[model samples]
Target: MDRRQLEYFLAIVQTGGFTSAGRRLRVAQPSLSQAIRALERDLGTPLFDRLGRGVGLTAAGEALVRPAKQVLRDFATARASVESVLGLTGGRLDIVALTTLAVDPLAALIGRFRAAHERVDVRVTDPELDNAVTGMVLEGDCELGLAESPGGVEGLDHLRLRDQEFFAVLPPGSAIDPAHPIEVAELAGWALVSTPEGTAMRTLVDRELGRCGAAPRVAVETTHRAAIVPLVLAGAGATVLPPRLAEDAAGRGAVVVPTTPRLVHGAVMMWRSGQLSPAARAFVELARLDETALPPAGTAGPTRSP
Candidate 1:
């Protein structure tokens, strides 16, 4: 009912128990307990039920969790708004990016943006590559999300920023030639560092290789772009990734091979339904820039970086 009571309940959920929550919030244990009890009394339902170890959320608790977080965020925003009436402050940018985007373009974009806007703070929320940005949209946490074309998110504003294509990254001394590119059949003999089966990348790679009546011999299965690049550079195997990722990996001495049926990647910038922040606008500008921050890509869509 009250902010204090809501805060108490949230503390309990986040820290996983009355005692731990009290410790985290720097509140006396007894006061934390009383506040939660008061909140339950106001709502006329138990928020949490005791399990063997700490505690677990009841259905009611689960339902209230997100709203509680939103309320807390709102309160913090309100306080910050009052302060900003006199002076401005830059808080964190809750962001999520797709796997392919996380490499050079995204990293370069972040570096450029942060360098310009030293007052702004940014936070990332990359989970599994596929749903990372969409999840941020659904949760209403991210201010802006950079993603591949996520098929099913609704009630959000989306803009296509740029496109990328996948390339074969070959190990040092690899027989695969950078100039010739690799054929669908050529992939079968090499160890592939692959995304999990059924992912967009995996499906594309598998389907392409299969069409040639071949399947890559997978050396390792991992979800991180950083991992794949290194394995290729180390001469362990080859992997497929977007152009930007390929370029970075190849800089460390791996060879990049163009593949049959060029793989395409898209970058989408999505925001929850609302007005834009000055910072968000600046980021949108940067995201639209060509892999290089110049020429036709900049002249075409979006505006200059702020």
Candidate 2:
């Protein structure tokens, strides 16, 4: 099947309907349908099954997703190789980031990368699952991934960007004194605003709390990482957060304090092991420079809560 057919197929999968995919691709609905039909004929199988007004991927379509994405990424990389002669005048860089690490290092690195390569379009998306960043990067869904990789992934090249320290964030007017570090066990009595179980953050929280022989009294469990701070601020419950986020929460009137046995994780950038596109290489280099500017892991002193 042609690249157009693959593009149309993926677009339909992403947008959830042929009409929506047509609008996204600026193609007529009939043409998009014809392209998919042609692709299915070439493969001798239907890729998508009609479901009322929507469509769902059939087994064949599910099987094609990874290879289709890889093919498209390879095509883009080929084009980028030729375009490199012009020095990153324009290209797309797709990144999948863990929800927790997305705002701090990713945002800062992207800001610097964009400042230097204004024409490059950087698209950042969250992984479907907390630990799915590596799989997404390996599957060619993204060129780069930012994740909590205490031990780097086996098949990918990685650069440890920073060590993140987790802190206890309490709601406004918390009786706990900010000057004193708190033990994880002390948090067991209070309800927590946490991400769902199985998420990286929740797993860490559970492990630490379990160490104290206490389980979290979860008052609010949300999949939306962004809402944790707000929920805590609203006095729903306390939460565990990284230093950067905890500091922000403090600035916004939440009480932040270091934990007795500090919770820390290494954040790393991962990519395919071989040669990278010029834009991706430049981004990696920028990350390296940024990392160097920061205080070495564990050396950076604790942030005093506001």
Candidate 3:
């Protein structure tokens, strides 16, 4: 019904109960309940169903979630627009990136962007699935998203930032030479520690392995990005990952062998196909500058950084 009511509803949904939402929003429980009840009345429906442990959204509440979020986004955009006219007073940039990339290009870019526009806020969202990054952008949940080889998403404008090389993460006491590139066939029949299926890196590795005439015998599949390091280190099995992650783990005495054909993954910065907020545009420009200044892929960047 109103911005405050919508805010309250969203908070309750996120925190899972009126009391929790009140604690998060620093509002009294009774006041938060009253606001949501008023919103439900205005819409002529029950937004939440009371349950013993926690409240769950009713069908009507589920329907209102997207539009309510959009309303809040628009309000933030409107405020930022007026403030920008008065010279970058208050603005925010919301970005979504893959968990692996949170270490590289995204970190450097964020650091540099913040230095220039200290007043503008920047938030990064890392979703579990690779597709969710672009989905967030397309759904108007975020202003920018970093996706790897986003294949033909209908309504996105993207720029290729870099192509990153992949490395073979050898288990402890691996016989493979760490100083040289490991040939494709070397991966055959090895029990591999891997990320879950459908992740960008996992998909790429699977395709490349197939091309090299082998299939991975997955020993363990995990969703956490950092879990691979410990798996390989503990001698679970060999794995393939972006160079940054592989090299970082190598410092722990894990052998990281390069692939013969140079397994490389492409990264793109994508956004919705429309005009962007001033803060978003500024972030893009900063990325462009950083990309130009960066050394050719595999030569420098997070993977190569000491």
Top model number, TM-score: 2
Candidate 1 Cα misplacement greater than 4 A, ranges: 76-88, 198-200, 207-215, 275-278, 285-306
By TM-score: ranked, best first: 2, 3, 1
lDDT for each of the candidates?
A: 0.71, 0.87, 0.81
Query: Ten residues in a row with the worst lDDT in model 3?
Result: 297-306
Model 3 CA lDDT for position 75: 78
TM-score of each candidate?
Answer: 0.81, 0.90, 0.87
lDDT digits (tens) for residues 42-93 of candidate 2: 9999999999989999999999998899888888888998999989989999
- Which candidate number would show the highest lDDT if scored against the true structure? 2
Model 3, position 42, has a per-residue lDDT of 86
- The candidate with the higher lDDT, 2 or 3, is 2
For the record, the alpha-carbon RMSD of candidate 1 to the native fold, in angstroms, is 5.5
For residue 199, what is the lDDT in candidate 3? 88
User: What is the Cα-based lDDT of residue 157 in candidate 1?
Assistant: 78
